[model samples]
Target: MNDQQLLRYSRHILLDPIGIEGQDRLLGSRALIVGAGGLGCPSALYLAAAGVGTLVIVDDDEVDMTNLQRQILHREQSVGRAKVDSARDALHDINPGTEVIALKQRLAGDALLEQVAAADVVLDCSDNFATRHAINRACVATRTPLVSGAAIRFDGQVAVFDSREPNAPCYHCLFPEGGESEEVRCAVMGVFAPLTGIIGTVQAAEALKILAQTGRTLAGRLLLLDALGMEWRSIALPRDPGCAVCGEGA
Candidate 1:
């Protein structure tokens, strides 16, 4: 690290857990974030600011005025623009040194697998079940650590899934593919704006810990938050031996 880099991340260097070595690891890491909405916004913000070597943001949606309520990466003028474009620009303004790849399309099949395989970590910030399951499958395939976060209405949840671990529960294990989950959209059911930030920030922390090899990650636990009640709870997660994606028979 140059003199400027030392100064830029001097605070991180002071931490015992993420000292110079850990900060250096963060600087050499690549992360793929699978959304540019509320959750993705804060995750991207902190990862970029922390000097992650490379950040890949994927999204096919355009910025909407309604999204501004929580998606801090987009501004009023960014409306109508592709979300990835706006997010890339915003991340650049924060840390031009960090390479940001903006893919303005929904990643699926080989495309998604390729990105997931290339990344050191994957953050599932998308707000849909299909995308979450797909991301989990790709992460499990690559043995990459995934930091997942979601927020709808006044509730939010976060979890870390590391296929590298023998019995870490994946997103599908907790919410099965064929399961009956009432899909709730922030558009239909109003979401508390800060709720997204809280969950996204936790995702960022988990991702950084994974990259820096700091404390133990939430590999076998799920963090849930009720913004309305202002309470937080954690649930232990167990891997499903019969999980189709990560099962031995698969």
Candidate 2:
């Protein structure tokens, strides 16, 4: 690290756990964020501010006026602009040293696998089930750590799926792809704005922990939050042997 970098990340360096070594690891890591909306906004913000070496953000949607309520990375002027573009600009303004590769498109198939393979960690901040499952599959295939989060209607959840751990549960183990789970959109269900921030922040923390190799991540646990009731719950997650994505058959 240069003299300027040491001064810039002195706060992280001061920590006992995340001292200079951990901070250096963070400065050499790359993260792939799979969304640019509610959850993705705060996650990317912190990751960039914390001095992650590189960040690749993907999103096909454009920023809308409604997003201003919770998507902290975008402003009113960002409306009608591609979400990845808006996010890139904001992240650059926060930390110009962090490299931001903004891809204004949905990530899928081989492209998704390539990104997941290259990243030190993947943040699944996407809103839909299909995208979540796809991200999980790619992470599992690449053996990359994944920080997943979701928020809707005062409810939010976060989980870490680290395929590097033999017993760690992948996302598919918790929510099967073709199960009875229903897709709930914030546009339809009316999400609590701060709930997304809370969940997204947790996702960022887990990702940073994985990158810095400092603290124990939420690898075998699922965290659930009821923002309306101000309650939090932690559930032990077990890997499913029958999971299609990460099972023996897979």
Candidate 3:
């Protein structure tokens, strides 16, 4: 770390658990964020601000006027631009030292797996079930750590699925692929603005912890937040040995 870097990240360096060593690890880590909307915005913001070395953000959508409500990375001028491009500009402005690889496309198949394999941590900030499952599969296949989060209406949830742990549960273990899991769109459901920020920030926190190897992450637990009621719940998630994605039968 250069003199400027040391000064820039002095706050993180001050934390006993995330002292110089953890800050250094964070400075050398690569994170793959799978969205550029509500959750992705804050997650990328914090990670880049914290000095994560590399951030690869993937998104195929363009910024819409509606997104300005909760997608903190975009401005009114960014409405017509691709979300990844807008996010790159915003992140660069905040921390020019952090390398941002903005891929304006929906990553799937080999492309997704390759990106996940190269990343130290993957943040599943996507909104849909299909994309979430795809990201989870790639992380599991590559044995990478995944920080997943979701928010809708007045509810939100966050969980970490670290395939490096033998007994840790993958996303598929909790929500099966073809189950009765319905796709709830924020556009249709009318999500609470701050709800997304809360969940996205938590996702960022978990991802940073994974990269720095600091305090215990939410690896085997699911965190649920009911913003309307101002209540929080932690649910223990168990690995499903029968899960097709990370199961003994496979």
Candidate 4:
């Protein structure tokens, strides 16, 4: 690291757990974040600020005025812009030295595989089920660790799925695709702004831990938050022997 970089990341270097070695690992890591909305915003910001070497952001949506409430990466002036572009700008502003690749298009099938294969870790920040399942599949195939986060209404959840670990459950193992889930959107049900921030920040922390290999990750655990009741609970998730996404027979 240069003098400027050493000084910039001195705080991280000062820690016993993250000393200079962990900081170097962070600077050598590449992360793929699969959304650019609320969860993606804070997750990307924290990763960038921590000096992650490369960040690939994928989002096909444009920033909407309604998104400004919790999507901290987009500004009012960026409402009409693609979310990935806006996120790239915000992340660059946070850490200009970090490489930010903004793909303003939906990543699926081959595209998703290529991106996930190149990343050391994947962050599932997408709001919908299809993209989440696709990301999980790609991560499992590539044996990459995934940090997943979601927030809607007064609830949020975060988890890590590492295919490197035995018996670790991917997102599909916990919430199967095509299953019955409450169909609620922020536009209709309303979101607690800080709720997204809380989960996304946790996602970022987990991602960093996975990248630096400095601490234990939540590979087989799921954290659920009920912001309305100020309650938090954690559940142990077991790998499904028949999980369609990452099972032994899958």
Candidate 5:
């Protein structure tokens, strides 16, 4: 680390757990974030600020007025712009040293698998279930650690799935792909802005812990938060022996 790099990340180095070694790991890690919306916004911001060496943000949507309420990575001036472009600009502004790769196209199938195979950690910040399932499948196949987060209306949830761990559960283990889940959107449901921030920040924290190999990642545990009720709950998630997506059944 150069003199300027040391000064920039002095706070992280000050920690007993995260000394120079941990900070260096963070500076040499690659993180692939799917989605540039609410959860992805803060997740990308903190990861960039923490000096993740390479960041790849993927999202096919364009920013809208509604996103400003919760997506901190985008500003009013960025409305109507591609989400990946806005995210790239914001993250670069936060830390120019971090290589920000913005993929404006929606990734799936073979393309998604290739991306996951290259990343040290993958973050599922998408809104829809199909994309989430696809991302989970890719992560499982590559044995990559995944940090998943979701927030809509007054509810938020975050979890870490470490495919490298034999007993760790993937996102599909908790919520099966074909299972029915009501599609809820902030567009109609009215989300609490900071709720996304809380979950997104946790996503970043979990990713950093996994990359730095310092703290306990949220593997095999799911965190749920109800911002309106001001309640937080964590549930133990077990790897399903018969999970179709990532279980013993091939």
Candidate 6:
């Protein structure tokens, strides 16, 4: 690292777990973040600030007044513009040294797979089941680490799925695809604003720990938060032997 780079990331280097070596590893990593809304915003911000070498953010939505409530990456000027572009601008402002690639479209199929394959870590900050399932599949196929998070109403959850680790459960292991999960949007149910920030930041923390290879990465655990009740809980997550995505059954 150059003198300026060292000074910029001195705080992270100060951590005994990170120090200079882990900071360098972080600077050599690539992270792909799906979604540019509430969760994606904070996740992208911290990853870039921590000097993740590259960040590719994907989203097809345009910023709106409603998003301004929790999507801290966008501004009044960003409304009506593609969310990925707005987030890229914010992340670049945070750390111009980090390369930010913004894809302003809903992604799937080979396009998503290619990006997932290239990334050292993938973060599922998207809000829907279909996208989440796709990300899980790609991560499992490529043996990449995934950090997933969700927040709606007063509830939030975060989990890490590292297929690189034996017995680690992918997202599909916990939530079956096309299951009974009713798509709940903040637009309809109303979400607590800080709830996204809390969950999003935790996702960022988990991703950094995985990149730095320090501490546990929440691979087999699920974290649940109830902002209304101010309570937090953790549930053990086990891989489903019958799970089609990560199961013994093909």
Looking at candidate 2, the ten consecutive residues that score lowest on lDDT are 241-250
- Tell me the TM-score of each prediction against the true structure: 0.98, 0.99, 0.99, 0.97, 0.98, 0.98
lDDT of 2 by residue, 151-170 (tens): 99999999999999987899
Q: Count of backbone clashes for each model?
A: 0, 0, 0, 0, 0, 0
Error of 2 at 229 (Å): 1.1
| Model 1 regions more than 4 Å off | none
Question: Model 1 — which ten-residue stretch has the worst lDDT?
Answer: 241-250
Q: Is candidate 2 or candidate 6 better by lDDT?
A: 2
- Tens-place lDDT digits, model 3, residues 1-250: 9999999999999999999999999999999999999999999999999999999999999999999999999999998999999999999999999999999999989999999999999999999999999999999999999999999999999999999997899999999999998889899998999999999999999999999999999999999999999899999999999999988885
Worst 10 residues of 3 by lDDT: 241-250
lDDT of 3: 0.95
After superposition, candidate 4 runs with Cα above 4 Å error: none
lDDT of 6 by residue, 1-250 (tens): 9999999999999999999999999999999999999999999999999999999999999999999999999999998999999998888899999999999888889998899999999999999899999999999988989999999999999999999888888898899998877888888899999999999999999999998889888899999999999899999999998899999884
Clashes of 4: 0
Candidate 2 clashing pairs, residues 3+ apart or interchain: none
* Candidate 3 error regions (>4 Å): none
Q: Candidate 4: minimum summed lDDT over ten consecutive residues — where?
A: 180-189
* Candidate 3: residue 11 lDDT (0-100): 90
For candidate 4, write residues 1-250 as lDDT tens digits: 8899999999999998998999999999999998898899999999999999999999999999999998999999998999999999888899998999999889999989999999999999987787788898899999999999988889999999999888888888988888886556677778899999999999999999988888888889999999999899998999998999888788
Winner of 4 and 6 under TM-score: 6
> How high a TM-score does candidate 4 get?
0.97
Error of 2 at 245 (Å): 1.1
Model 6: which residue pairs collide? none
